[model samples]
Target: FGLTRDIYETDYYRRGGRSFLPIRWMAPESLRDGRFDTLSDVWSFGVLLWEIATLAEQPYQGYGNEEVVHYVRYGNITLERPPNCPEILHKLMRACWTFSPGDRISFRSIVDELVPYENEDFRLNAYYHTQPHSQQETVLTDSNSDEKDLLLVDDNASEQQ
Candidate 1:
């Protein structure tokens, strides 16, 4: 996740000139720098909007990662959502890919905007954990200290869950 220009220059991009970034899933700030926030990730997800609509065809096809880097640096390759894409989605994608990081929309806003499509069961599936409490406790306590403490506590707990 901590992608940097130095790494990009030395690694994948040098081999094929295009790194197959799957930019749809990558945070844009990753294309620029590592100090990005969630908004940058949302921007990547917005790009995913187009990819999903097109069944994962490359974003900005005909360019590799290096070419994309150059084009992005020069402000040349503005992404256009596929012609058949919906206007609401197109606008959403635009907000996600804005050059200025501050201008990108928040994930909360995106979810709010998409709320109309959600069903009652959809809300419940996410809001409530289905596993019984006893099962959860059993799983949490079953791991040995070595396995449980392999990494930092904060992240490990989440991983175990």
Candidate 2:
């Protein structure tokens, strides 16, 4: 695969030492109990989507690390959907952020949901139909809006093999 993540581990906390954690991208449960499980990865992926949607803007822009933990873990706050993000991706991100781990969408299901969007038809539906191959980029433009979006993908996807 062009860029794949391999995940295989259980949640843990060392008994008598300090540990580094990704504070902003953590799930509520992870922040609460130091439990970083697969479901936590889903939550982090949602934040990653938010980062991409914001063109790398930091999540909870006005909040400090402790504030993020308090708001997300106790206040049940989540980042609002970016104004320019496509509905489909935003829906996926929301699913990934479900508070209950059991309710969070699985990675396999995320792949299944996104698989259909790989086709030209879905791009058209999303108003991202242009397919200029030179830079390996697909551009999304809306006639009524000034914003433009770019998506880069490999011509030879590993899934094709």
Candidate 3:
């Protein structure tokens, strides 16, 4: 139901008298004041889900690193839901991307939301948007997480049959 590995411990990047950051995957707080916690990890988790739903497509595909930050900060923009993703999963991703870390869903709540799909009835693999939409598998995960994220899902989440 879960997995964990040691993250190569490092602070925000610094070298050559230049600063580097994984701005694309970083949460607002991390970008703003260098704060980090599991909630920030939640933000990264949302990005991972986007990557999966889009079949490994880049997050914020056309935005430059700086543009990604500008949109998130000034415009309150987040990655749009993938056309092939289910509403519930998109909702979960949105929750993870909430601007306030405290408002973001906890890893435990994510499990509660996703557990309903672990049934043998639903297939567990997701396909590209170009493919037929009916045959989706729902069980999911992201790295750097305390929880094992599994399966993308549909509205059948609470409406499980």
Candidate 1 lDDT score at position 140: 37
Of 1 and 3, the candidate ranking higher by TM-score: 3
The alpha-carbon deviation from the true structure for residue 126 of candidate 3, after best TM-score superposition, in angstroms, is 18
Pairs of colliding residues, candidate 2: none
Candidate 3 regions exceeding 4 Å error are 1-19, 121-161
What's the residue-level lDDT of 109 in candidate 2? 96
Per-residue accuracy of model 2 over 53-89 as CA lDDT, tens digit each? 9998778877666677778887468999998899999
Structural RMSD, model 3: 14.1
Query: lDDT for model 1, on a 0 to 1 scale?
Result: 0.65
TM-score for candidate 1, residues paired by index: 0.60
Which lDDT tens digits does candidate 3 get at residues 1-161? Answer: 23454242132233346766667778888877678899999999999998899997777777766677777655377898898799999999999999988889999999899988765544445334244645545655666677766647663556566
Q: Is candidate 1 or 2 superior in lDDT?
A: 2
1 against 2, candidate with superior TM-score: 2
Question: Looking at model 3, which ten-residue stretch has the lowest summed lDDT?
Answer: 6-15
Question: 37-119, model 1: which lDDT tens digit per residue?
Answer: 78778877887888887776667777676777766655567676687888888888887777777777889989788788778
Deviating ranges (above 4 Å) for candidate 1: 1-28, 119-161
